[model samples]
Target: MKVRFYFITITLACLVLTACNPQTNQIEKTQAPQVIEWEYQIAYQRGMEAVTWSLPAVSMICMRNASFNLGGGYNTVYWLSEIPTAKQEALTANNQTPYANVYLNTKNGPVVLDIPPASNKTALFGSAVDIWQEPIADIGPAGADAGKGGKYVFLPPDYDGSEIEGCINVPSGSYQVFVALRCIPIGGATFKEAAEYAKNINAYSLAEINNPPQGNYIDIAGKHLPTLPDYDFSYFGYIKELMDTEPLQKRDMVMGGMLASIGIEKDKPFIPNDKVKSALTKAIADGYNYLEYMFETPGFSLIKQWEGRQWMNIREPSNDGFVFDEGEYLLMDERGSLFHWATFFPRHLGKATAYLNAMQDADGNLLKGEKQYKLTVPAEVPARDFWSVIVYSKKTKAWIYNDLGRVGLSSYDKENMKLNDDGSVDIFFSETAPEGMESNWIPTNGEDFFLLFRFYGPQESYFDKSFVLPDVQLLK
Candidate 1:
């Protein structure tokens, strides 16, 4: 029978949904409880859990797959010759700097990432993450290489390699890894100069270390790179590929069984029946909604960055790396929430940068592109390099589509920006430039949008909560 056909085979004694009323914060009997098919319910619930557990893995593989589609394979750098725009199509990606990435595979032996030292004040920022999206190590001055630059090696899971040295040896738990780097123009360097310097980044297998292979770099500047995870059946396919390639972890054995219930197994061929596919199809859609709910819910993970403000920190204050290991158990929801909308976190929390999320105005209303909002950046931002505010569609968690090729405003645009007498700049967000504020404005495409304020080289005042960013006020 079809999956919906079983929906009619409902039984009594079970509520259709056990949701509490938001206003009352309590369960009520005002509505009658409905019934659901037992077998379908069991499978659907398991499918939801599978989506949550496998989010990071699926997101990582999405980047790898998209890279391959762009004619770049494993251990080849995909560097950008210019800043990203809407066409880049990565989740919560910024237009602040040029991105450089390398998809690494170490099943055979080990892979090497040779990052060049900072020159002319241009440096790389970001981390080398595994298939799980967990940082194997941070990559810049604030990271393992300490900006001096050196050879970094990624070893396959449990590889019996003899004494590894002279390089940052990152032991991986999976065969798939990716190095995500952003080239920043620091100390009066030009963006064009920084983009050119990113070419020095190289990735090759350990065997090719002596004679590193050349000319595999694919420039993704202003190009369409589809790297965002989707709520489709193919999402599970990515997870399965990861499972098949990665050595099984003791902690994931239970999750492995859950995935099997939905016809996704590591070693076995996947052939889901129509009935099973129907359940999973619905599960992914609902699971995405659940993640959105979690992101907005209070006391979940979005902690207010400034005192009594609506702006929130993207990741909760936790130990660096976002493992969410809380001694007795893991914070699955917390960890999943981070990867759900964003990607590539540093191993050290706020070591090189800080991110603050803005979804609502000074009042508690959600931000809409039809309405205009203005945020007053403090006269002295703690960012040493620059501070940027970018907008993304809240639904897609990606750049808002626009014809102007504009998505953000940063301190780098000060030449055009109109700053107040005190040096504080007022940044505007709306469908069109708010009267005469073109230079300090970002478009939101008349859709439900959110903001991410970034601080490159965050200073002591930022960490100590002294440099507080004010809330965005509605333009009345």
Candidate 2:
């Protein structure tokens, strides 16, 4: 009996030893190193995509906050009396037109915009953008009135109200909408006259239009507004704020899941552990690097308009509303790249404007401020309304500040500029104006800058790849 008891006790002791051994415990509790590494990598990749995909929304939130800080919050219009000068706080602005805008929140009910009729040479060109900066509708010109101007109602996504007759209905995809208006000074109208016409533009809730208050106008000219997101881990904070403000759609669920994986879900406190924080930091850096590379190396082929001239059309020719494949699957990467390079406003081919940018000079070198260059714009620029070329800082992506205080040259000012014998206009870019070329000079302030060529109301020539801009040539 004692021998039998000794054997049983020995067996129990062996079992305990097996359970307590560190190696055995590790074998049961730990995952394979490869598995853990793969999980981490997947998390990192999703984090990167989340940041890239949410850039537009984050940009909207940043702009909203900046506008609020600049004294115009929700439901108020901020009017720029003059064209955006170098000191104007904006992501990217043009000196050709006076700007006025109002941020609308239609959560409670529909908001009514009373766009005054175009008077004389003053006309308003407006566009309504959702939270993602997707073009909801063109407001003034290229809208239902075709620049005649009329009352327009912006309804929320969940709006199920009776249709009101006579008013153009603009159904928005999100609760937050931005009505960006530009006052074009045509027919020799002055900027001040155009600004006065912009000030007459009114926006108010349908419930309060009968007793509407005087329009709140916050002049943002020469004032600084921080519209760009902080390019760091803190950028996630802006994303979180955007998620909280804008309701997520069914298509955005995947993005929401990705954001949640990085501890940035809506209504949740974003308190990430050290490991997660480190992973997110690395992901942001990787995303920026990848996007920069993608911008430099054109992923989509450019439709060469002229020999040796490459102009990239941001929108896909076949697709209109959404960027989808033949299978109807969303091209997330392509969409992300387009928004990263330019603004979030995506319009249809015909009603929309086209943008072309050049970072390098003709000699394949970065455009430096200290160097002198010339760009000869071909005659008969094919734009229905107008066209302009604006120089911006490569770093800020905003208008370059210079001693001259000029940000752009427009076709409207063609009379003042000298045209070549062939009718092409030569534009000069230099720190100092070339002799007898003050009218064509665009100052660079001795800092690196890039060019943005805008074709507002682009015609068939632009889409057919018939119109091409000349390269910037280095002056001898």
Candidate 3:
């Protein structure tokens, strides 16, 4: 009976798909509420999965009673669908925790690989996580050889003493290794949740690395990978259906679509089934109902709360002095802020905005409050492109009011900005415009705001830590 029902439903859905009119077939209100609700939940969940680790061009994070989407930071996210097999093995074999040395057991004891310069800037198993590899036929085990399996592992930083005795096995072929000195910084409860999240995400990332879709690979490192496949798109249709009818499912649908958009899409339509038609016009009407729900309770509810955080344990502090031990919130910053946060939408959802706003500094100043920030681009930032800083509202988690709906200030504004005596540049931010800084002023409207610092054509100064940003503090 259930099978029969599904078949009927799918057939109807297919018919609906065929009849869909690009111009006039939109879902409507006062329609099949039950079916719409169900579709929305399914769409939202799937959409979230597609984008959980995929990078985006811009993303929102609830910070200080406002939405803080890292619009232009300097890192990226490699979705599992986008990784290559060879890199997966490299990432596995090269996995190293803090303070652990690789050893080869000769009868006279173990000899480690020639220790390279701590400044080599090469990961111990760097090549493995290269996001480069040939397609693999079998994903589980490569060959009969245990060593050849090329299985990757991530150990906590504090695995010392007895934990070091056991050797990790790998394929017998000659191999090179790189170590990633990476750690995550997050609150306690959030970290724990993120770790579990990471585990699921890692599975997806590895899957992509092992068997990327052919022709889906984007050009990188002077080569092309056919491994990364476009994200599953049926979910969008599901969201559209849900949004039209189900109120509770509205937030999840939007969240899901936003998340899925973070991964490889190959120009696929961002909106749900632009090609489908609906026989039950009532169902189409449901979409209107869903949009209405988006404006109501928990529709755009920005607060996300955790009993505490969950993340990997910190073995050592990062270059930024933030401890990244085991079981703490771990976020990858290799991709610029915009890309990384965009894919990890779940991290910024729920009570996150409320929590950020809750951080008060005792004198009643907002913790990480809005301030008149002075930004100047020295002649030396790195990248092939330009950069920008934009702000969003905490309560709404959307880009705040913009005269031109611009998200942030960008290098595109360089010619329009005031120049400095030394060839550097300057920009300002504040709740109220300062007396003489109108040209560079970014208005805050007395609300919380996040500043994203970006540098295009970044040079050695960026990689070598010669450039740093002043803290975001409140101004009198």
Best lDDT among the predictions, by candidate number: 1
| Tens-digit lDDT string for candidate 3 (71-107) | 2111111212211222221101111111111111111
**Residue-pair clash count for candidate 2:** 0
Q: Mark the regions of model 2 whose C-alpha exceeds 4 Å error after superposition.
A: 1-43, 299-304, 321-327, 344-346, 349-354, 363-366, 383-386, 412-423, 430-439, 456-465
Between candidates 1 and 2, the lDDT winner:
1
Q: Which pairs clash in the backbone of model 1?
A: none
Q: How well does candidate 2 score on lDDT at residue 453?
A: 84
In terms of lDDT, model 3 sits at 0.30
The CA lDDT of each predicted structure is 0.82, 0.76, 0.30
Q: Encode model 2's per-residue lDDT on 184-244: one tens digit a residue.
A: 7878988877887877877888887669777888888778877776768887788888778
* Candidate 1: regions farther than 4 A off: 1-36
How far in Å is the alpha carbon of 327 misplaced in model 2? 6.7
Candidate 1 per-residue lDDT over residues 168-231, each given as its tens digit: 8998878888788888887887677787877788888899888988847788776787888888
TM-score of each: 0.89, 0.83, 0.28
Q: Where is model 1 poorest over a 10-residue stretch in terms of lDDT? A: 11-20
